[model samples]
Target chain A: MSLIVFAGAAQFVGAGMFGMGVGGWEIVLTTFVLNFRHFLMTSSLSRRLPDNTTKSQSALAAFGVTDETFAVASMSRDEKLAPSYLYGLNFTAYTAWAAGTVAGVMAGSILGDTLKQSLTFGLYALFIGLLVPEMKRAKPAVTAALCSMAVSGALYFQPFFKMGSGWMIVSATVVGSFIAAVLHGDENE
Target chain B: MSKLNIIILMALVTYIPRMLPMVFLKNMRLAPWLNRFLRFIPYASLGALIFPGALFSVNPPAAAAGGIIVSAVMGLMGRSLIAVFASGVAAVYILLLII
Candidate 1:
């Protein structure tokens, strides 16, 4: 899954849904929605790549455009992004991700049930860890997050509106971000 | 769908967003409204992923809440991802042990 999906959040969400026995389409749809941010990152990074970069090279590098890699690439002081640099960066990050998954699996096998159950919260911790920084950085981020929490909470808990987790996430994200975009108007960053 | 089939489809969907913009939309600029919408997706999606579900993730909901609070506090303090994540797991473990 790590080698194929190559996305942390999507993999985590997919694993959780799979554990709960959700349908395959739900997993696929949720993965797509969760990973849609890659479009923005790759679109922004494309401008920095040297004009002479080949299509194959760009395609290969695109597979590695995780948030961490994008941040490192975007922070480079060089005017033109070098293909070699990108390849190296992507290679390293990809290797680490795959290797980390292997390590996690090995550790999981060794861990007891109680320890494993406790570790379930690690996934939520990851989301909160990633979101809280953004919430603190901008008021609009807070608005978007709060709105999403409200929508998803309702969708999950309300009998009338009860839906699959996949749909719940998709709807909440769309409505929350759309409201934030309309209300904040992109000025606050 | 079979697991292999699901994995293949996931690969395709994941690749689309990463590949299309860099390969085909290289020179194009998104409209301002669309860009703003995309910009907010991460926060919104992360939020949706965290709440309500997180509460039920573990046996005792309070253990999960403890993990969340530790994570959020460390995150707000701008701690490293590993620190926040490990501390959160630790908090849950401790809470579970107590309860």
Candidate 2:
């Protein structure tokens, strides 16, 4: 918890100046754009947690859910458990992420643009890693990937559909999911 | 407010969608439709991320060229993570200088 707080706060203190070219709205939009996955993950994990929670906490914790936290919370742990377990999982994950932000800042000075840029691929790699394992057991995952990639490629070159990069993802996800849910689905799919 | 403040503001706004559900919705059931919708997130999320980076430059072809090759090669070869990240970055960096 302290680490993530430090990292997030430290980022503001350090490179917050880089916001000139990128407006607050743009940054905010992109932030929503970039981490939109969390939203979907939350929707899924909600079912995994306790069946009751207040709107306020839902409003608050929804902001913190990440792919990792979602995975941790969603994992079948013996059986249905308390929401407190999810809270603890989230708190720990938040701390780790915020810590990374701070660590990223310190590392930023040393890491040049190329390396920094490459590091962004870590997310990409993580997705691939996760998908690879899932796909091995569930063919639906493979179908989803191919379908999404095709959609992505189609949208990438379209001129009039300049919906920006973020929305494109939302489109692809919806399309892909619908296809998977409807096309090649068993109960698990 | 300072530009830095704006970025921080953006970060906070971005953090909201991610953090809110954790604290609040941790123990709720998503509607069946929404649950179905959630399955596609990883695909969309990953696509959104990689796509933007590809379009980050005017010379999209050349800029993203190296890293794409590197990642593909590493994946097909089933190489280690370090090699995957390092080679991909190096390929793009080297390509950028030459292009």
Candidate 3:
């Protein structure tokens, strides 16, 4: 999953660089845009974990707190968010992500550059296929999505902000999510 | 600009935001209002990624028109997500192939 994120970043950066070359601003923007979700994930998970959990455990477990890991942890019915279990979930996910990335990068090293380029779209399609189901049944989820799109679109054209697209994306997501959560936090309760 | 430098810069910048909340948020509880905001993150993020690329495809207006139509019909008719997305994907590719 991280690798997919990386590939997406690579494409955006590579394409941007290809067209405009590297600007410090573009790099700054793309990085921010692509990474905002992790912060959201962390914020949510930190709230979900048991209050008694140790700081070290919380921090370590956070290493694994991703969308996939969050889904797993949140789904577990246990009321107390055990640091051990959270860390365990993080362990497995990080391991899986790292191992998969290594295997892919190593294997990709053997593939032609064009083939690798083509694989980029497959990642987006895979992401879409995976993400679409999550949005379909949940109205709040759909609302949240629309909010993000609106924010991103608005940001794209705004001249005053002068921020890179990446950071802009993050800002849009964070703010969009905040709006979604405010209106829809009721369902969880 | 070297690819390595650009990638490393992205790595550091991206890493800070992604990892910061976990390290710092351990002490911070979700405020009543903020909880509502978090629920929408995944949905919105996915929307942010998908809508642009799909709508801005080779034949933006046409493919988007088709995707929008198919998505609406499938969604309204209570078809499965797979069915809904399949219709949209088919619409996109078919439109692309034609144009």
Each prediction's DockQ?
A: 0.57, 0.30, 0.34
User: lDDT tens digits, residues B15-56, model 1?
Assistant: 988998777755457787766776676677677778888899
lDDT scores in order: 0.80, 0.56, 0.60
Q: Candidate 3 chain A: minimum summed lDDT over ten consecutive residues — where?
A: A117-126
Q: What TM-score against the true fold does each predicted structure earn?
A: 0.72, 0.63, 0.62
TM-score of chain A of 3: 0.61
- Measured by TM-score, the strongest candidate is 1
Q: Write the per-residue lDDT of candidate 1 for residues A1-189, one digit (tens) a residue.
A: 888788888898889988999999988998887777677667767776788888888898899987567655654557578878999999998999888778878998899877898787877776776778767878878988899999999888887754666567778878888898899984854
Candidate 2 per-residue lDDT, tens place, A1-189, comes to 232222232244234534345455655555556555565566555554455666665655555465555544443333444556666776777776767768987999998776566555455553443344444556666666667767876787777757655566667766776676666544654
Badly placed stretches (over 4 Å) of model 2 are: A1-18, A21-37, A52-60, A67-89, A112-114, A187-189, B1-34, B47-99
Please report how far candidate 2 places residue B39 from its true position, in Å: 3.5
Ranked by lDDT, the better of candidates 2 and 3 is: 3
Candidate 3 chain B least-lDDT 10 residues? B51-60
Q: What's the lDDT for residue B71 in model 1? A: 90
Candidate 3: give the clashing pairs. A29-A166, A32-A166, A33-A166, A33-A167, A145-B44, A181-B36, A181-B37, A182-B36, A182-B37
Clashes of each: 0, 30, 9
For candidate 3, give the lDDT of residue A12. Answer: 55
